[model samples]
Target: MMRYLDHDHDWLVAHGAIHTAREIAQQPRLWREITATLQASAADWQPWLNDLLATPNLRVVMTGAGTSAFAGKTLAPVLRERTGLRIDPVATTDIVGDPQAWLDPRLPTLLVSFARSGNSPESVAAVELADQLLPDCRHLILTCNPDGALARYAAGNPRVRCVLMPDGANDQSFAMTSSFTSMFVSAALMLGAVPLADAAARVESVAALCEAKLALWPQRARQLAIDGFERVVYLGSNGLAGLAEEASLKLLELTAGRIATRFDSPLGVRHGPKFMIDARTCVLVFMSSKPYTRRYDDDLYAELVGNGIAPQVIALGTGAGDTLQVELADADDLWLALPYLLFAQLFAFEASLAAGLTPDNPCPTGEVNRVVQGVTIYPYPN
Candidate 1:
């Protein structure tokens, strides 16, 4: 049996976790492929993207459901700061229910949809509603499943441009691992302010850093998993704050509610959410690399340590003495997110295993599904 990280394939497969484990392990390679693919295909989509971005008063809305939705939340801040574009990260669930609240009929809108399966009811409905409500709306569909409804919906449409993620990005696991990171990297490279060549170099550096961290993380994650923490809280700032949301969801999904989880920005946690911490809780803070943001992150880390309420507290970043360090001092918080996320992913995977739940499909009872089920689409009143 092949060994993945610390476990043999037979053991992982018997535990129903091989797919999830393999998917998590393959992210670095997949990210490289995504970067290369974007660079190679820039000619086909760049003109369209350039033209749409060039439009005065263009609103960029990033939409998706579940983990896919978190992608937008993570990227929108960085994109807005760097590109100076008016970008909004709205969930498809929200858009589907009330299009008027999100879609502006007066502005030329670019709907950037992120989906692993591309078949969610809300995802498809959001695209359709944007077209109906906004006369000058265009779509840039980023998805793993080419045959899915969202991808197929873009076929031959002059107003829509669809980009397929690298093969194997369509994660077979119930939870998204490789799919999330691949799509996140793709969008960062294509829509971010960095030039393609520079973006590729940054990606390479991040990927290598992650590869090194992944080698050392599984052991630490396994230890944390078996440490008997009943709750986990993830905290960060800015883009990393959005990523903290996704990281929190992974543990909740993989453990099938065996471990309760919550996420908040470093500064935001001081409000009411800090009450979630207790003796049985484990806290993971994703520290920002930016000097300005790192102050807030460090202050929270110090406060948490000083409180001594949680059983375990971990800080992740390029800083010294962190539970896990990636050593990318020059990298921005956006680039640092990749490595920080990998730590969260591995921890969730190990925690699931420790809880004796199937990482591949935690709820085999069908209450939850790989692709969400039983969602009904309602028509918008004209």
Candidate 2:
């Protein structure tokens, strides 16, 4: 009996969740494969990136939509510090709408686009707008589909470079599971200031950690999903806040919005978003690995646990708290992000099953699509 996420393969397929479950379960192996793939092909793309990154006053804007967009947001702060480059994680929706506001035609810019399919109308529109507005602009597209629009756009274009993730990184599930983390890892390794040798080692460690979590989290997550919770809150700080956004979305998406979800920074929640918490809320905080940042995360963990409002408060990462710890105290937030994302994905999968919804396609009516349909891309003014 072949099983994924502790459920029989036939069982998941019958429930229309096989694709989502397999994609979620296969992420750790995909992480290792992508690292190896990137390391092998470094010679081809490294020189081009070296020149672009070395540009004076270089501004790197990472853009995508939904989960793809969250990947850049999660890594932007860390990359800014590590690469010593001015990096902003902007959304393609924002870029396509008002190109003049988000883009500066004067600066030498590296537009890093993250996408699973690379077919979003706004995504391709953003790339075209950058070429039109910024003469000094160069593009780095990280996509899973080699045949995607962005990948096709890279052909015969000297200003663009496209890196396809491992073969199966192209997820088939309506909700992105492996594709999100694969792109996130690829971006951190290639774009962040980490050396290639060190980057390889980091991927190994993080992949192992997540593999263990995937094996262990499914049953526990299923139990939590059946706990009668009405709302879920995901809280984190710094880069992890972007992760929290992705996590919150995963739950809402997988459960077809049957479970209310909210995401915020530990401190930011107090500014008024904390009102989402009640007796039925389950709060999961992605604790930071940095000591200073961990202090803030720990403070929120204690406050949430002591508040007597939410029924469950989970703080997982470096330090000990109300919930379990990942033993990644010294790991960079970027590496720790993989395992954190795995847990969130697992919980979302289980929550979907508990809600009697199909994780593969929660919305069967074509209202919310896998590739995002019905977006009309209008031409930007010159």
Candidate 3:
């Protein structure tokens, strides 16, 4: 009767179908809004970005907390290859706890902060710490909330640049559906892909594909969630690896950590984390679109299927696979993340319900939060 948990098999099946379908429909709206924002603001962004690019020794540090951190992680490697600049996704939590290790006083760094609310304590603290530790530091704040701390941070500072995403990107949902995708797109445009005008076609394609496809994912995800797995492991490589991290967190947060979760690269997992797999676990592998990367992913999937460590193994790919194949026409793995992530999010939401937890606020007991709590900001010594 519309309760949180999916008790009936029929109910779970129906829910997963609805969730996937909605994602496919909503993705276009998201893409249009994002492209329009960039086109309108190109004049301002182009000059600012060009100036930042002029710096010879540019160190780009993508900083955020939780899922925001994953956004950076997903973007950093691609940015390094595309821009030929040094980029790293450093968690604000890590920086706040230990400043000296992350902040190099010698390097001329461009601190790119990805924040959804822009008000999180670590978000603000990371920016502040960069200013304190790095002598030649500039700020480039990407956020959905214009009134957020990161957006307003550039008000008087000529050195700081702030780019506000589309209004819908500041998603009001319990989870970061549009917000996550929008921010990731913005970073890709500003850092990796072609100019705003050039990127319009590809972005539109990606959005259209996702909207057309999301309708049926909810039912699929619901079934997977109700499979009664007690553990989940997400695997990917490169940028998709960062997405795997985000997927893992989504399941853990939505389920209030009731389901033990872990994420690692396809190659990295073989080294040690493979032990996390068990008979009751579900392994979700994000296969790459590139031929080379896909080889590694294919090998690991074969190993997982052959070893039979887990009862359920799901692999998301652009084409056919042994199980749970979600085709994405001819898109790259980077863009494929949109559909893969939608599936993961729906799975986690359904899993949360199956575990008898609320999706809106999974942690009422106060461990994890929408905007994390109880993080005391310490004064750094000069």
Candidate 4:
């Protein structure tokens, strides 16, 4: 029997999950390293970042593919509120398909590109398109792979600055674990309101909280997995909603579609997506740390419990009596998101194991790949 966080390498390899499990377990440590990397390199990027922020009517576009894209989605709202910049989270998939639609040449653009491998055709294509179309466009490439095409593209480019994540963040598993959170934390430190000193302190606290959650959540998550829920629904609001989307994708990817999953904001769920809930569904709600937002989150949590539709309903946050509680007092939504996400990652990993799927390469038949394959990039008409 494979155990969570305590299994031998032989057992993990036997279960075909050593890579994913190790990557998941290494996140907190990697997050601390990311914090240090960001601090050490602040002098290199901060001046350029400050100058960019000073520009009037600057348009910041955060673009990436798949989970990388969700990093942008998760941070845009809070970054907009904090920086007062007009920020949009567009996917490279969308940009590559229709660059003219997403890239406005009229505004001075700062394209923040997030990528794990940084070599996805769509990711490289989007950057090339931005350079071609925008009269004044700057690139901030955050990637785990230092040797990736995107990183190489930024070399000695006056208009571009690239930040490489810590080693080991380039996840070996089919799914993104450390790579995702490291990039997310890096962006928050680089762009969010938290100053470098405060950001490092916050990351330490959040990492500690995650370390605790990683230790405690597996048993509960495994139980939920063993319950054999046919579907999973993840809910949150604002930035957490974007996180909910990532959480949903993690479960779906880890299970290799053995479980159907959906994600939506707490209020948005009432619109129509709530229909996804059924008796066999497991609902995981990422509760907001903000008191005002928590009101909405609490209401939904009560409603979901009151309905009694889902076999298991988990509330993950700093709230009292929550199923997965991490009491991060007065933490910004961005920081709180880290621990919340760690819980989601752990839950998904456990669920994948419980479903008898190989978390390392859930789809070994080449249907889905760690790095997406077999795509032909077409030239855009000038």
Per-candidate clashes, comma-separated: 0, 0, 15, 0
- Overall local distance difference test of candidate 1: 0.90
Candidate of highest lDDT: 1
**Candidates arranged by TM-score, highest first:** 1, 2, 4, 3
State candidate 2's TM-score: 0.98
Model 1: how large is the Cα RMSD against the reference? 1.0
For candidate 4, lDDT tens digit of each residue in 1-382? 5454656778889899898888888888988998898788888999999899889999999999999999999999899998888999999999988889999999999999999999999999999999999999999999999999999999999999999989899999989989999899898888855788887777788888878877777777777788889999999899888899999999999999989999998889999898999998999898887899899989999999998988789998776778877788677688888888877887788888888889998888989888888888899887
Question: Which tens-of-lDDT digit does each residue in 178-293 have in candidate 3?
Answer: 67777888888887555666788878777766555555666788899889899999998999999999999888877877899999999999898999999989999998888998
Better of 3 and 4 by lDDT: 4
Q: What is the lDDT of residue 145 in candidate 3?
A: 93
Output the better candidate (2/4) by TM-score: 2
Worst 10 residues of 2 by lDDT: 320-329
lDDT of 1 by residue, 1-382 (tens): 6777679999999999999999998998998898888888889988889888989999999989999999999998899999999999999999998899989899999999999999988999999999899999999999999899999999999989999988999999999989999999988888965788787787888888888877788999999999979999999898888899999999999999889999999999989999999999999999887889989989999889998999799998777777677788487878888888898899999999999899999999999999989999989987
